[model samples]
Target chain A: MIKVRNMTVAYSGQPIFTNLSIAFEPGKITGIIGPNGAGKSTMIKGILGLIHKQSGDVTLHSKPVAKQLKNVAYVEQRAALDLTFPINVFDTVLTGTYPNLGLFKIPSEKDKSAARQALADVNLSEFSQRQIGELSGGQLQRVFVARAIVQEADVIILDEPFVGIDMKSEAEIMSILKRWQMAGKTIIVVHHDLNKVTKYFDDLVIINRGIVAAGKTADVFTKENITTAFSGDLSTILFSDKEPEHA
Target chain B: MRSIGLFIDGLMQYNFLQTALITSILVGIMSGIIGSFIILRGMSLMGDAISHAVLPGVAVAYMLGINILLGASLFGILAALLIGLVTLKSKLKNDTAIGIVFSAFFALGFILISLAESATNLHHILFGNVLAVSDNDLITTAIVLAIVLIFVVVFYKELLITSFDNTFAQAYGLKTQLMHYALMLVLTLVTVTALQTVGIILIVAMLITPAATAYLLTNRLSHMMIVAAIFSVVSSVIGLYMSYTFNWASGPAIVLTAAVFFSLAFLFSPKQGIIFKKKIN
Candidate 1:
């Protein structure tokens, strides 16, 4: 299990959240959904130690995640990467193995083969030699996904992985996540689409600066919880039978 | 062509010619390797800032009777550190921070130069006179080159990962802060080594142009470094030959040769050349 205890997260001295606690069960596909400015991304980054948390304990199996960052694979938002950098996709994917390779060690042939296999799994085997900038948005996302697969991490965290991606790539990524779940790995994703939340995730952690509800998708993904999460203004549109993107 | 051959032979005959040729080539190779990272990170302005930022240190070193390279490297790193600090502490963007620090250091350099007018020649420090290479200068350049080369080779993967995606670097426990400082240290060392050959005014061009030209030609970082190094060596050799034959200023000649190569690459490179791309209907 992954546990976040009594965490207070702040950015530039402004508190985003206070006394927040959440637990993620093992071998589950978890979605963190929230409105804008709700600290959805901030919460994940805080857990990863990418952002400073004012006070918190984020642990996996009762140990701090910071001490075992190698056990985690993270794919950041697409906008966070430099697409025009002069590195081929193969080299980019190979970096996933770097944390495990440790200091002053190069990737071995086994590692290269593992990276190649991950690329093949993502249906990007032929595009390994292409520059990252030449790839379409969906293809680039899959490339990063392939990198995460090569990491062989116990916990995989993806932020906004489906935005701007094609439906085919989305299906492919979902299937890949399913396969990882079958292997008993933990998958945490930050998502925005309310329509697919229950269909895609087994567990949902809903928030709007603080946790509104968190449990199995069927139990916690309710009209009242979502209404409270988005506030009174969005409740009508959110509960409307037809799905619009949540605010 | 005959004059070129005679020039090569003449270069072989004189010890000063040999020293100037060897030092310029070394400076060219080192600059190309380090500059590959600079252009990739889109830190061209930062490169310019650090190169110019070393000026005050050089002037101060002259007054204090200290080794100019040591002083210059310290100030170069100080400039980079200050630029990073300002960008973090304030809302100013990187280029704005660069502008503020580089111009201030450059202005301070001029003021110090005037104060030390009797001890140094401003022209030599500004444009460089490559033919006046001292043995100690040669040794210092060589040592700095070796150190920069070794670090780049040893940490090539870490550097690549950090430069490509620093957030991923941080998430994966790559010590990106340390990688950044290490790169800044290498940049300072490269600027210090190029001080006597390219001088402060044109050192940034020497650092950026070759790598940028190679970037136009290749899609891979390793190939970029190799192609840039080759371009650097060829341009340095031809520029030195031109300087020897025509009595031209060596620094401008070298930089101009590099610029010419960049122009050619920009116009005719098969992959990314602006002029040669097939137009859409």
Candidate 2:
């Protein structure tokens, strides 16, 4: 489990998140849902120690996060990646083992096998040798997921993992997360799709510049809570009767 | 032909040829490895800019009687760090920052050169004389190259991940800022050493051309690095020969040979070459 306390993050003196506090439990799939500019990604980065927090501490299973780096793996938004580099799928996936290998040592046969298995898990085993630039957006996202899986971390954090992916690939990725949860690995995902929030997530943390609601998916997703968290107007449109509320 | 034979015999007998070969190889290998990462991260322009900026550093060192490599590396790293900071901290685009730094530093170097025209051999620092390479320069190049090679090999995985997906690598607890600074330092040292052997104008060609060519030919970093090293060493040898045979400038000849390789890669490389368009129906 990971814990964040009184976390505040700012960029160039512009405050994004202030006094945010939350805990992501172990062995559950937790969805972070919020409208655009809601500090969802910022909170994730703070937890991962990618960005400096003005105030607050993050801990992983009672250890300082900096000392427990190998316990967590993160799959970033696909948009943040450069796809034109001359890297193959296998090499990309193999990079996930870097933390464990540390500096200087090459990947062993065992690491390569784990990478292959991770590719197989994502149904990308056949594309191991293929150039990453030659892959579709969905396939590229899956490759990143395969990398996270290969990391074999206790916790996996993914930022908008399904964005721009087709429906089939989305379903495939959701199933992978379900399996990860089944395997007792904690999964925290930043998601924009409100429809899948209830179906896929065991817990929900609605964030808006700070922590808005933190509880079970069903409890925190109530109409009143959703309305209050999303400023009421957007919630009405999102929860309209014509649109099915849950996927 | 007789003159050519006599020149070859003279080169073989002189210590300068051996010095040039050793120095060129050191510079080439360092640039080749560092250049691969620079191209991978799309920081080829940064490499080019840093090479130019080192001119002021070398000028100042020549004036102060300091070690040229030391002064150049220090200033180059400072300039690179400043560029990185500006790009990361401010809203300025990376290329714009690089342009500003390179122009300002190069102009400063020119001013310093003019001020000290009577006291220094400016050509040795500007377009270096490989034939005049001292033992100390060789030692310094060797040390810098060895350190750079070790760092690259040791952090290959981290570098690969960060270059491909910096956000993800950072999110996974990689110290991406530290990695970026470390890489910039290595690149600065590589460029400085390369400038001493190949001159500032041609250092960029040596830094980027081999890697770019290898990039066209391979889809793997490891293979690309190997091919780049081979290409760089070949170009260095051929350029040396051309320079000796035709009585042309060594720096321009070396860069021209590398450029020739780049053109060949552009024309004949299998996957990304212009001549071999992907079949899309």
Candidate 3:
């Protein structure tokens, strides 16, 4: 299980979340859903030690998660990367093998095979030699997913992976993620699509600067919970279609 | 074409010409490799800043009778670190940090040069006198080049990962901050090495122009490095010949050659040039 206990996060002397705690067990597709500026990404960053937490204990299997960050495969938002960087699709995926390769070691043939296999898994084998900047938006997102697959970590964390990609790419990503979940790897996604919340993830972490609710999607994605989380305004506007299944 | 034959003859006959030619080639390779990363990271201004920032160290080294490379490298690394630190700790961006720091160091360099009674020619340090490279300067340039080359080879993957996606690099347990500073150190070393060959004023051009021109022509980083090295070595050799034949300053002449190549690439590169790009409907 992945656990974040007594966590406090602040930005420039302003509190985003305080004394908050959340847990994510293995073998689940978890989506951390929230409105903008609700600390969804910040909470994940804090847990991964990507951002400084004022005070927190983020443990994986009862030990500190920060120490074993290499065991975590983190795919940042699509826009965080430089698409214009002079690298081919295969080379971009090969970077995932680097953390495992360690210092003074180049990617060997075995690592290259893994990268190629990852690319194949993502259905990007034909575009392996193409430059990253030349890829379409959906293809670029798939490239990042290929990178993450080559990481071969027990936990996969993606921040806003579905944004700006086509629906086909979104469906493809969710299916790949489902395969990982079945293999007993933990997956955490920072998502905002309310209609797909119950459909995509088995577990949901709803936050509005703090944990509004966190549990199985059917149990915790209530209308009152989302109304409180989005402060009633966005909940009505956003959840009018699907209504959170049990809300 | 006949002048080129005469230039090759001169290279074989004159030791000074040979020394200048060899030093210019070595300087070309170093700047080409280092500058690839510099432009890719969007730190071209930082490269210019570091090259200029080493001036005060050179001036102070002249005053203290110390090795100028050591002094310049120290000050250059210090300047890079300070810029990184400032940008990290404050709301000021990287360019703002560079402008404030490099100009201050440059002004201080001039003041120190004025205070010193040493015989180190400020004009030579600023504009370069490639024809006057001594045996010791040649050795220094060679050593710096070897070190820079080895570091790049050993850390190629790390540098690529960090430059491409720093956050992912960090998440994968790579120390991005350390990688950044290490690149800065290499940048400083390259700047110090170029001090004698191209001098401070034109070093930025040597570092950026060839790599940028290569960037226009290549889709891969390794290809960019290779193409840039070719451009660098070719331009420097031709520029040296032009200097010898015309009695022009070697640094500016070499920079002019790089600029010419860049112009060609900008207009005619098959993949990215403006002239050949198909207009979208």
Candidate 4:
């Protein structure tokens, strides 16, 4: 349901993507995968209005996406957060409710209950009182996921939520995404684990400055597209079976 | 040893001493609260820069024969805005931008002050003389404290989320930039108010050390703020005593008192102290 129309995005006056158009399918998990500096994060951030877009508009359900940010949940890369901040897990999760709360108002009891339920959902109830500084990398990622869960967004977009996390935490997060997908929420992820592409994404948008290919995982995540997106000659040797970090 | 008796009598008899005491307490609590946000965000350098950057504003206000608060706050915010602007518009890193802007503003302040040939003591503006604080200065400090208290109470959640993770705040359409600039505005107010107590040079110490000490002692922002406030107030009280009993400058006394607390916390704080580290292991 979210569509980026003829979007051109640049950072510091240098164009990364130009005149690129893509529409993500609703109720499906679409992974945006690419090589280093391939505009995966840039494209999503641009369309979501998180970063500047040189030209274009993004819409959700016939409304401008900017007007409906309340319905979209975006989880940035975990490494971007301040790990030493003085906040506990429960309060961090409670931030999700802030988007829905009106200005000059604090989260109500109902919102607090939602946060509690979210923490329970993510199996972080026991650690709700713990500071984020004490959390393991996997646990911290789960904390953000718990926050997103509490938001109850119609669309969830995450940037590298699985990277650097333990296998169990990765499985836990993917399962939640799967649940959201079943509930008809549009789930868009910036991911690069090629080995799990078939198992993870319902659709794939692979890019190298521009969309090299797009469509269903079975249809577009082929050898030819991989070669083009990863810059063929070197990718043939580098694209091994193991899912090495794509950063 | 010097004159506890005389200092106590002065506290009871002298209006100036009373005003100095009240202003120092207000400034202490104010700096403690604001400093928590600065240290937590890893913006200690920015804190240092903003404080020093207010110097030119004070100098300009003297030249214009206007209120120091008005001119100082205006220039403080301008310096903050320019730092942000240069960083975003160029490839230069944030520290480089801060280094360029604040030092330039400080150097300009020195030039302006010399050109203005003001009657006010240059040493006082740079190093603070709390004993000379007027009743009007006390009133200003109180007002700034009230503003800081109300701002923190009303926008607690907004500031917390933004300070901890700005990208998450931005994702949900919260105006992170507004929160940022708003804090900068408040920082300017605090720095301007602190001029009579901590002065420009040592304001960074007041804004950084107590909050940093609290950071090592607590894991909750609210608790950190409360502890920092207590630590700052205690420093001011003891520092005032030292200033009165001994012939020491008030600002350095207060800052040294804060530094001593930081040292103690660094050595003996139960949860996160170097001494406790060995014991726990």
Candidate 5:
């Protein structure tokens, strides 16, 4: 479980998030829904202690999140990676184990075995030796997921993991998250698609600059809440009772 | 046949040959290690500029009768730090800032060399005479190469993470700026140390060729460093032999041998090389 209290992040005197508070419970898939530049990624980064939060505290399992790097795993957006580095699928997944291994020691046989098992979980065992650059977008995303699995952390934060991925990969990722939730891991995913929130997320944290609403997905998916969170204009277009095509 | 045997005997007895071999190896190791990071960060041109910019530092030091390595390292470090800071702080692009600093520093060195032509042999400062390498220069180069290698290995993870994704590394609580400056410092020292053997015109080849060849052969950073170091040592030895046999400049001969390795890597490396084509079907 993760607890964020009165968190505010700023960059160059401009506040990215102000007076935000939310809790991500264990054993549930929590989807963070927001418009572009609405501080969703910043919030996740703040919790992971990746950025300097102007004022706030993020706690994981009753300890400061900053001190618990080993307890958390992160899957960055695929767009942020360099695909031409010549790293293979296996090596890419093995990097997730680095924080645990520290600086000096090499990856042991156990670590290699764990990486292989993680690949197997994603049905990518056959592709372990393939060059990362040769993989498709969906396969790359799955490789990142395999890395997170190999990390075996208590909480996993994925930033826009589904972006540019096909529907099958997206569904495959959601199923994996569902299984992770069942195994009692806290999952926080930054998502853009409003349509899939009801189907995939058990808890929804709708954010626009700050926490607009945070609770069960079914209760928070109301037309009024959607409209309020997205600033009424776009929400009306998405949640309108009548199809716009008929009009 | 009798005259040739006498000439060979004289050549074998010269102390300069031993000095050249040791100096070239030390310079090769330093340049190869530092050059790996430079090429990885896409700062090869910056390395070239810094190497050239040290010419004035050497010229000034020779004029003042000071240690050339110390003087040139001080200047190179200053230039490198200034370039890094300016690029990070200002809106000016990195390549443009490098161009400006490189041209200005090199031009200043040329002017100083022209002024001090009456005091010393300026041509030696420019092209360098490997046959004239002293014990002191060899000792300094060896010390510098060892220091550079140790520092790189000790800070391997931090350097790798920072070089790969600076913003992410900073977010993860690593000191991105400090690491950046540290790499620049190492690069300056490496450039200065290499200048004793390779000179400014050929220093870039020594710095970049081994690393570029290693890059074509390996994907892992640690493995790449090992491969680069091996390539550099072999090329330096081969180059020295060619220089001795053909009666040519050691610096160009070493660089030409390294270039041959690079061309071989390009043509025959397993994954990305032109000759080793991937199965696309």
Candidate 6:
């Protein structure tokens, strides 16, 4: 299991989560769902030590997760990427091997082969030399999936991996992730689509600043729980392909 | 063509011209190399601020009889950190921090220079005088260039990943904040060494124009670095030639040369050049 305990996270001095705790077990596709400002990404960042936390303990497989970072791979939201950066798709995917190589070690033939294999897995072998700016939204998201595959991390965390991509790409990425689930890797995904919650996630962590409900999707994905977490605002909006503007 | 022979003769005969030529060329190469990263990271403003912030440090160095490199780097780093702290701790934007800190240090520089004896020499810190560069200046520029080359060769991957995506870099346990500060420190050192080749104001141009020109010409960072370095060297060589022949100011001439290269790339680059871009009928 990957666990965060007593995590008190704040953004700009305003507390978002106070003494909150959550655990995501392996071999399950876990989804963390929340409203726009419910701190879904914030909570993930806090636990991973990406953002400062007032207090917390993050552990994976009975070891501190921060110390075992080589076992962790995270693909950020698509919007965080700099499309104009002077790098090709192949070099971008190859950065997944960086943590393992550390500073001063050149990427070897083994690493290059791994990156090439990953690009082929994502059906982007021909696009290896193409600049990232030239890619479609679906192709771009698949590129990141290819990067995570090369990372070969036991724990994978994705933040809104399906926000802008087409349905076909979404299914393609989910199948890759499901294969990881079968390999007993922990998968934590931040997803906001209401209709797909039961379909994509086996366990749900619904939050609005703090945990509203946590359990199997069938048990914790109730409309009452969602309305409470969404704070009675669920009735007005329909779950659709378009996502709310990120807060 | 005849003037080119005259410039070559000047280089072989006058020791001053030799020092200036060597220093200008090395500084040009260093600016291009580091400038690639600065423009890519979108820290061109930060580079400008650091180059300008060195003024107060230069002033203090002159007054205290200390090495200008040590003093200039101190204030340049201080300005960088202050800008970062303000942006992180408050709602103030990056540009605002740059404007406030840079202008304050620059004004202080002017006052201190006015009080110093033979401060006419210090005025060159604002507008470059390559002819005035000493052998020490040449050696300093060379050392700085070597340092930049080694830093890039060693940390190429770290810089690439961090500049491309901070979130991914951080998640993979890279000390992204450290990478940022380390880049800023190297930038400060580059700004300090740039004092003789290009002045504070035009150093920004040297740091930006060649890199921007190369950015237009190539989509790969490694290729961009080499192309930008070549453009920068050509600009400095041509600018120095103009300065020696027509008695134009060295810094402005070099800046203009870089600007001219950028214009050519903007018009005629193969892939991204504006001229061939298809417009909807």
Q: Who wins the DockQ comparison?
A: 3
TM-score of each: 0.95, 0.91, 0.97, 0.94, 0.84, 0.95
Q: Relative to the unseen true structure, what is the C-alpha lDDT of residue B75 in candidate 6, on a scale of 0 to 100?
A: 90
Docking class of 6: medium
The backbone clash count of each candidate, in order, is: 0, 0, 1, 0, 0, 0
lDDT of 1 by residue, B1-281 (tens): 99799887888788888888889989989999999999888889989999889889988999999988788888888898899999999999989999999999999999999999998888878887788888888998899889988998899998888878988889987789888888887888888778777777988988899999999999989899989988988888888888888988888889999999999999889887777685421
Each candidate's chain A: what TM-score? Answer: 0.95, 0.94, 0.95, 0.94, 0.94, 0.93
Per-model DockQ? 0.82, 0.66, 0.87, 0.72, 0.30, 0.74
lDDT of 4 by residue, A104-190 (tens): 799999999999999988788999999998999999998899899989989999999988989988988988999999999999999
- Scored against the true structure, residue B189 in model 1 reaches a CA lDDT of 82
In model 6, the clashing pairs are: none
* iRMSD per prediction, in order: 0.8, 1.6, 0.8, 1.0, 3.0, 0.9
True contacts kept of 5: 0.14
Model 5, A209-234: lDDT tens digits are 89888899988876677877777877
Q: Which segments of candidate 4 are over 4 A away from where they belong?
A: A231-247, B1-5, B115-118
Q: Write the per-residue lDDT of candidate 3 for residues B152-265, one digit (tens) a residue.
A: 899999889888898998887789989888888888888877877777899999999999999999989999998998899898888899999889998888999999999999
TM-score of chain B of each: 0.96, 0.92, 0.96, 0.97, 0.90, 0.96
lDDT of candidate 1 over A1-247, digit per residue (tens): 7899999998878889998999987789999999999999999999999988889899988899999988899999999888888889998999999989988899999999999999999999999999999999999999999999999999999998999999999999999999999998889999988888989999999998889899999898877888888766566665676445444
Q: Which scores greater on DockQ, model 1 or model 5?
A: 1
Model 4 lDDT per residue over B1-281, tens place = 43878888999999989998888999999999999999888889999898889888888888878888788889889999999999998999999999999999999988887877655778888889999998777887888899999999999888888888887778778899999988998998999888788788999999989999999999899999999999999998888889887868999999999999999999999988999999988
The digit string of per-residue lDDT tens for model 3 on A7-56 reads 99899989899989988878999999888999998998998898888988
* Model 6 segments more than 4 A misplaced: A231-247, B278-281
Ranking by TM-score: 3, 1, 6, 4, 2, 5
Candidate 4: residue pairs that collide? none
- What docking class should model 4 receive? medium
